[model samples]
Target: MKILHLFNELKFSGAEIMYVSAAPLFQKLGCKLTVANTSLQLGEYTPAFKTAGYTIIHQYIPHALLRQWKMRKELIQLIKEGGYDVVHIHRSDLRWIMSYCAWRTRCKAVYTTHSVFRSHWYSYPLHFMQRWTAYHLFHCTFQTISDSVDANERNYYHTQTTLIYNWYGSTRFYPATKEEKKQTRLELNIPQDALVIISVGGCSHIKRHHDVIKAMPTILKKYPKAIYLHLGEGNTLEEEKVLAKSLNLNQNVRFYGNQKDVRNFLIASDIYVMPSKFEGISLTTIEAMACNIPAILYNVPGLRDFNKEKECALLIPESTEVLAKSIIELYENPKQQSTLIQNGKEFVDAYFNMEKNARKIFELYTKR
Candidate 1:
């Protein structure tokens, strides 16, 4: 089977990583996998994809509507020339174009909605318009890959969508040894005695870095040696840094912008906390769980689906007081912490294995 995967950017994100991880598995199963991205720069994960023996196609086009139309025309030509069995689109903008192009080219198209929430308010109108185009103009056969039933239900009811869970890649991100943790901590200038709290996501308001900062005073009161590490980058970094300085948490808080090896950082941390206001399925949570780091996340739709309180993770209400209390409680009880960590690993291994999920997707593609 020949498959063409479409993405807007080749950035080191969950969607990009998922495609890179799954493409090799597909290739091993006697399938041809080709990747196309809007950006010429394939970002951090390009080397891994190249090493896996997959072809990368860069489609340079501006985000403007006219440019997108021309790009769609070019993409349709490519699909026709390649005679691909399937076209799978990961990003929303690309999904729209692929929907139209595939319909015109008489090719099967599949869309995976990685994120349930739009990144901006403008995206609302754009997505709604795309939905209209997909359903009416293109007569597109749509499917959604979601981590939670809430996301599934929302898409199904709102747009008559099909749903699947985003798979967790294999056990590459395991717990680090004492020596490894010590070396990583030293590199980051984190004290060995400190109770390290790591949050990995683009630094944005939706991820709620502000909420985490607000909870810190209370958390620090209990665990005086607490440290917060923010991983990844976004437009909000400077503002967050200013907020940290204002809160007098400059020493306790550190922002490691866009590290290539986040698995190392996850291994070095004592706990993984995600205070995001919204999500589809959090890859960072799965990575942390795989690393045997206990997770403390908001009891929101996507997060709550993965983390059962006192089971795999500690699910707290979306409040600074509640989050702080949970952090302190977890810090106080080492036995509970260990149990959560073990449970997290077990949960991910059982439900989120990438190879298994990719096989399911392969089956879907082969369906008549």
Candidate 2:
């Protein structure tokens, strides 16, 4: 079967990373996958997709209103000519156009909701119209990656969706040995005895990376050698860097932009921290848990879902003081940390296994 995965701008984000790790599993199910860059310009993570053994194609969809119709026509022609059986869309911006084109070409299309978003008052009318058109007219199906996303879609679109939980690369994201951890820290130029705190995923406003940075001063007071590893890059990266510098926390915070192997960083870290405003079940958080690192996530929609039992991770209020306190508390309490680690590892192993979830996605494709 031929499958085409569509993205607005391919980047080093959760959805992109999850697919890269799961693509081979899909291929194992006898599917040929093609990824299309629908934005005006290609993204930096394009090479990673190509490395995942996908045939890369460009179907530029301009943001201009007048140009979308022509681009939509070209996209329809491409889908038909490529003989794609499934067109899986991972972006929301131009989904209506993509779904319309996929339907016009008579291909089964599915849109995966990777995050829960709240529409503004003005966007409600357009959201309703476009969503109605996509679900009814285009016959496009929706798939949500988390319970929060599923609930949000049901509330907004009034539709039932395929709820497929997100997964991570279990083999690559497992715990590291003592020697491996020491060696990784040495290679990364981090002190062996220093406390390492990490937060992976794009540095976006909603990610609240700045919240973590703001908490660094308080954390530094407790553990002077505490180091913050900021992985992934986005619009708020420079602003975060400036914030760190302005507060004299630059020395403690290391901004290592997008990384290919974040597992090494996770393996080296003592605690995983993500103060995201929300998430669609963050792949990074699960990866950290799978790596046996206790997590401290903000009590938000997507992040809070991981704390259903309140045993796997420490879900605290979104406050700089609380975040700093939680990190210090987790670091000081090794027994508590160990409990979280064991429970988190088990939770991820039980639900976020790539092989299992990838098969579910493949079934969705084949069934259609």
Each candidate's TM vs. the true structure? 0.86, 0.96
Clash pairs, candidate 1, are none
Question: Per-residue alpha-carbon lDDT of model 1 for 284-350, expressed as tens digits?
Answer: 8988999889999998767887754337988888998898888888977899989998899898877
Candidate 2 differs from the real structure by a C-alpha RMSD in angstroms, to one decimal, of: 1.5
Cα RMSD for predicted model 1: 3.2
TM-score of 2: 0.96
List residue ranges in candidate 1 displaced over 4 A: 39-48, 61-72, 118-141, 147-160, 177-189, 308-310
Q: In model 1, which range of ten residues has the least summed lDDT?
A: 149-158
Per-residue alpha-carbon lDDT of model 2 for 1-368, expressed as tens digits? 99999888888887888888888788888899899988788999999999999899987777654577767767888898999999998878666888888888889888888888778999778777877888889988888988889999898767668998999887788899999999999999999989899999887888989998999999888789999999988889999999999999877999999888899999999999988878888899999999999999888888888877658999899899999999998899999999999999888888888898888888888775
TM-score for candidate 1, please give it: 0.86
Best by TM-score: 2
